[model samples]
Target: MGIVGYFLPMLICAAIPVQSLSRNAETALCQTQEMQGLCALSGKWRNQLQSEITITCKKGTIQGLYDSTVGNGAYDLVGKYLQVNETDYIVGWSVAYKNQHRDARSTASWTGVFYAAEDIIKTQWIRAAFKNPEDYWSTFTTNQDTFSRVQSHPCLHNNRN
Candidate 1:
């Protein structure tokens, strides 16, 4: 099977919401020690694609805004740390994409996951263009990106060209 065919099912499955865990179970899974390091991943990360992603953790959820060669957008991510075997994953939906006009531009619903480690987030995203509802599933393109945390510089905040 081709790449799209191979990942289509997985993408569909990822979209399905999993059952919520109980308070005690959640506490056991998302330990304070494990989650502590996740805070360090909240800062700015520069990806191989030269995109800058700024992530913030709030109430067990991650909010991210990214500026890249393609475009600028924001996503709301939610996930958990499975302390049993030491693995963390975050899934997010692209909430909005801003165009050159600084207006809200509607794009494909981006659904992806970030596999997290010490200071890195391995991202695999499938962008499906849905201009035609009937053929949306066949229009997906995948991107595998790696992002590493970097110390922020004052000049980086300036958007001047």
Candidate 2:
């Protein structure tokens, strides 16, 4: 057999494990276990301000949120602000994919927020901005198209029982 016939399948199989390991590492890194007590908004929340958010936090849970509107709902613990008109907390999270291969385009970022009592998770795409480099808020872009690059990005968990 020629090189193509002998190594083609082998090369494909070898790619699988490497991909799986990379995804596993990402999931583990994103889990809230590492954050522990840092997740202050462990309760649900409602928005009272004119802003476009209705967030709810799962009790003792720290899950990420993704919103399509409002800078793709990009937020940072120290930079983003949430105003609650009702009882509870505002929970927000983000996901990003960095491409190691020069051939593939990198995704901007995915951000989301949860409205506790409503049990709603909104997801949106955002591109990184450089207006106010020092402030986290300035780095947010409300563009949903940025998600295409990371749509194939794997999730840490499987809902399949």
Pick by TM-score: which candidate is best? Answer: 1
Mark the regions of model 1 whose C-alpha exceeds 4 Å error after superposition.
Answer: 1-38, 72-95, 99-118, 133-138, 152-161
| lDDT tens per residue, model 1, 1-161 | 78455334322222222234455543443343323323333446677878766554433444445666566443333333222233444544353455554543344333344444565666666654545778666666677777776642111122111
Candidate 2 ranges beyond 4 A from true positions: 1-96, 99-103, 127-161
Pairs that collide, model 1:
none
- In angstroms, the error of model 2 at 126 is 3.3
lDDT of 2 at 98: 24
lDDT of 1 at 78: 31
What is the Å distance of residue 25 in model 2 from its true position?
Answer: 21
lDDT of 1 at 137: 65
